[model samples]
Target chain A: MTIGEVRENPAPAASVVRQPTFVVEPSKGWLALNLQEVWEYRELLYFLAWRDIKVRYKQTILGAAWAIIQPFFTMVIFSLFFGRLAKIPSDGIPYPIFSYAALVPWTFFANGLTQSSNSLVASANLIKKVYFPRLVVPISSILSGAVDFVLAFIVLLVMMVYFDTLPTWNIVWLPLLLLLALVTSLGVGLWFTAMNVQFRDVRYAVPFLVQAWMFATPIAYPSSLLGEPWRTLYGINPMVGVIEGFRWALLGVNTAPGPVIIISSLVSVGLLVSGAFYFRRMEKTFADVV
Target chain B: MSDVAIRVQNLSKQYHIGGTQAGYKTLRESLVEGIQAPFRRARKLLRGQATGAAELDETIWALKDVSFEVNEGEVVGIIGRNGAGKSTLLKVLSRITEPTRGRAEVYGRVGSLLEVGTGFHQELTGRENIYLNGAILGMKKAEIERKFDEIVAFAEIEKFIDTPVKHYSSGMYVRLAFAVAAHLEPEILLVDEVLAVGDVAFQKKCLGKMGDVAKSGRTVLLVSHNMGAIDALCETTVFLEQGKVVDIGQTPVVIQQYLSSLYDIADYSLQNRVDRGGSGRAKINYIYLATSDGLPLQQVLSGQEVMIVIGYESQIPLNHPTFKLTVYNNVGQPLTQFDSSLTNALFIQLPLRGYVGCQLGKLPLSARRYRLHASLDNGVELLDHWTGAYSFTVGPGNYYGTGRNVVGLKDVCLVDQTWQLLENAPEVHWSV
Candidate 1:
């Protein structure tokens, strides 16, 4: 279908202030983001999120245990290699407590990347057969990763007790940081998932990207390794603020991640906005290319 | 719009149909085209020339200038041969894909069983998948809870509901999927080709459920290859051809128009996509059915030659073998059996054959679609046998004028004729 004359309705737009166009014309011009329509389908978002959770744990020998085990064992390995042997800095907190806190968010990000990157390809049958907002597939993948995030947070609680550390008033900011991480994951996920549908090379590229990203973030080491603007520069990774915010909230860092956290938060939101725009732009090609 | 359940005006979807090369354009090609595009556009503007967007290369309209509206509670069947844009139209209506040209507004909550078990997890138990699929099909958890028992009973998987679905047979999987889709109520239901998966009995059950749904006043859009199912369920049918609405009218008339165009070779060429199954493992060139009198008939008269010829490529000699052919009806029921092992040509062998012709003489059959099932094997050790290889149509016929050929025959494969003249019929009074 070629682009035709644009038709505008006088209906009031939703909270997302943009001229919401129901029709999409690929040949005409730039793609417009329709958050209003997406907002209407929010119930579908919840159902898809629920479907992902049920399917993930259904019939698993470990069931929900795998969720806890992933972050927990990761805490152990980081403790052995980076904590005791390598003598990596933990910002004065017990290394075990420090790494476990970072592992919680890192695991969510890693899992989100893994699931969302393959989502479109994995749901090829659904794409070819039926119609729905294709973005729902990857978005649900990210949301479901939130389930494991909450479950793994329990282990972080136990680590806090073992360290005899209680969360400070700063812990109120934890939800905001978690939102930052979520936005970041969804952002990167959208880009990779759309690419994965076309190039298929993204499947192999994802694991490598995640591994490099983990070391790049302060998951195993502290952002302290790269001092000053570089650390703030490292905040460009976005997840740095999320992990450092958890450490600061639970372990009480003297500096509240300060400029680094702000930089990281801003970068994370930026990634999310740009990723979504790219995804919306490329969405029209998916049905044909996939 | 009369509170239209679904409305579309000039809905069109454009697909690039990408080239074989990755990234589509190489760096050098992009460089050359990049340099040429600006110059061409500038030259055209300076010379007061015109540019036609339609001239875009490799551009094909999968759906073009399509428009329609469906009232709530209507059962509409989208009928067309493959690539006629029926699926694309459905996809746009369901919002699976956005329309490239026009606008479509679907009122009320829409539930699409686009494919059976669209989100079914293999590792999940049948019970778990019920919940997963229910949610995927847009059902609330409480809604699923209310219908859980009915769904289980309908799928007939109560005994193994707790077991992982991966362990269930393909039939069980489809049944559970159908059950979930059937029980969940939504304002509108969009079903694709899933009905073709389940067995005959299950298909009937699904049809019955769909009939109930229609009576309950919910919009239903069904797309199926089975004309019989469409005629029985859909009150109106829309025919699509080459991405255009060719016809939309009463079920029978629309179907007649669609099938009437099927005799031409173009009809067959448009649909066949080189199916790889049954005889795919063996090297076969062509397979066709011929009458006993050596006449190639598309519509066979009952009690005519039902011979099958198989062309194959063989590089080496073959041993003493038996060839078996079983004929099946359209519904996959075996109507006749002809095994070479039972005939005198049991030990025949061909040495380094290039092309071979085999024949079966048959003068008995009922009016129906008969498929050719063939197998070539040395006794005991099976080489290859094509199960449900080819199909031909058999028309009803009367063999005898006096002794009605419809004489009751013991064999199901036997074609017996029967006739009676109402005026000449005799009536006898009981001697009480």
Candidate 2:
């Protein structure tokens, strides 16, 4: 080919004049989120979530089995420590089954809390190197914990069957509770993840927070034991509602958990929106700081 | 009314140059600043503020007053030296960082391959990373599954696809990462210099894949130091210096312009003052390359007397912290190396901050340029190093050497070299 011929193209491809379109502006306000943009990058979200799952299961002799083992072992320890030794109340359900049910969602929440908080910092290489919706990192981290949730749920189901206590009609309420759990986890995860990007101390503070949080929640005991007003106020800890609801729905526990569920759901959703805005506000500095 | 696929106008991104420690301003200080912000902004908007005189503790604009446009399907290359703001521009364009001033508008789905294999888990197998990377690039799970075999084949890593990426050589990781990114099929693709990771063959494949994407009527922005690749693939090029667009024009013209101007920058003085310190026993004060007369020469001709000057300071002088210099060929293969302390020049109880200037006469280095890899070591302990002293060219000269045949020879000999000679055989006189 002649040099000129090499320079001349066979065809004019897509000849559209490039013009400047949108300028990225820093999000204003204390907590402002453009969720639409994140929503648009949903494909990236799915892949990151999938990648987390595959990596977690990749080379081990027991692949997805590790997901079940973590929560299963934690449940065993909790049952032994609080159930047998402390003689904590379980709302009349078998201690193992009761704690395991609550542990399923709590494990999901705790894992999501730790992973998502560190997500922006941990993916510093990727964040610095590529551009996508920064929220995808932490959200995927939270979603990745879903694998453990599913695996542990199976164990929960087996435990329920072994105890010969089938879930009541209230079991249909399970999806809402699961969504509630996700919101609560994501909300808290977003705040910590954003904070962790700016202050690395957040990473150190997260595990200790999770440990303290497990004690604060009634995973070992019943929220009902707290009595009136305090019991109603106890729902301010959103997980109280989730754990109580899990027991009520699965074991047919008589404590209606009434206004507690309503209050917790509102609180969880509020945390999610607030956390998302906080994350978005802080996200502008992530590439620079991280 | 030209069709502009990407448009940037008056764009600027400012960054505080110091550590995050600067982030901690007292609450009272913040309150005072918060009260003043609105009035300051209003006054600036009403009348343009002048005299940016107080430059200390000031924000450095990574990209300032940058404006450009790229039509659909236009493949553009961004070229610049280190810290010249190529990455910053890409970050702003890709929406990684919001520009502090001005605006940039991008139409269509933008996918950035800033660092390939980003999100690859070391504990995960190559197969998993591919899917993960593909997803990060915005491909659907179903889409990746369908192209799974093709990606694996293109990476030429089918045998170890199931092996964790940590076990794969960096080359394999890069190949697999590029394959996933190439197949992502975003409307607009922004690539950084991460392609430097792969082997030559894989890089060629990556270039081909990028070319195919551009040909299929997709917009691409490529940033690479490889002039050959830029010349071959990019239709147009943009040159950025200190975060601003210096030139934007046709490919070969802009690249040639950039290469020439690179030589024009005479910041060789930075190499004159050297600071080497990092858990080291001996410290190097000055490192330089000088001509026969001990005059520092920025450029060198072949067969010249090139002296290596090394000044150092020792603390509790030991047997090592051996001052060494190694010259590597263009492809990073060590050519001719010299270590002073190994040759019994080890100075014991050396005066603190002493000078050790070694003059090697009649430097036999050929026309090709080489990097001086100077380091100090105590046996296996690496005390300090000047990773780079400036590189100077060696011009062809009248040296009576037959091995000069390898001077301009490119490719294999330039990398793996050997010397051979013609000798007279007593029995075989086969020449006509």
Query: In lDDT terms, which candidate is top?
Result: 2
Estimate the TM-score for candidate 1: 0.67
Can you write out model 1's per-residue Cα lDDT over B1-432, one digit (the tens) per residue?
A: 224566667878776553333243688988887798767754542332322232244556889887776767888888887788887877777767767787776767777777788878887788888887786677777889899999999999999999989999999999999999898687877877666657778887887888898778888888876665676678888888888888777776676566535444443342243333333233444355444322234455555555554544444346665656777766778766776667666556765432334564445766655666666665545555554445566666453334344332333466344667789658877897
lDDT of 2 by residue, A122-165 (tens): 88988887777788888889898887888889888888889998
Off by over 4 Å in 1: A1-44, A54-65, A72-77, A225-230, B1-7, B16-59, B103-108, B265-432
Docking class of 2: acceptable
Chain B TM-score, structure 2? 0.56
Off by over 4 Å in 2: A1-22, A25-27, A30-32, A57-66, A69-81, B19-58, B194-197, B265-432
Q: What is candidate 2's local distance difference test score?
A: 0.74
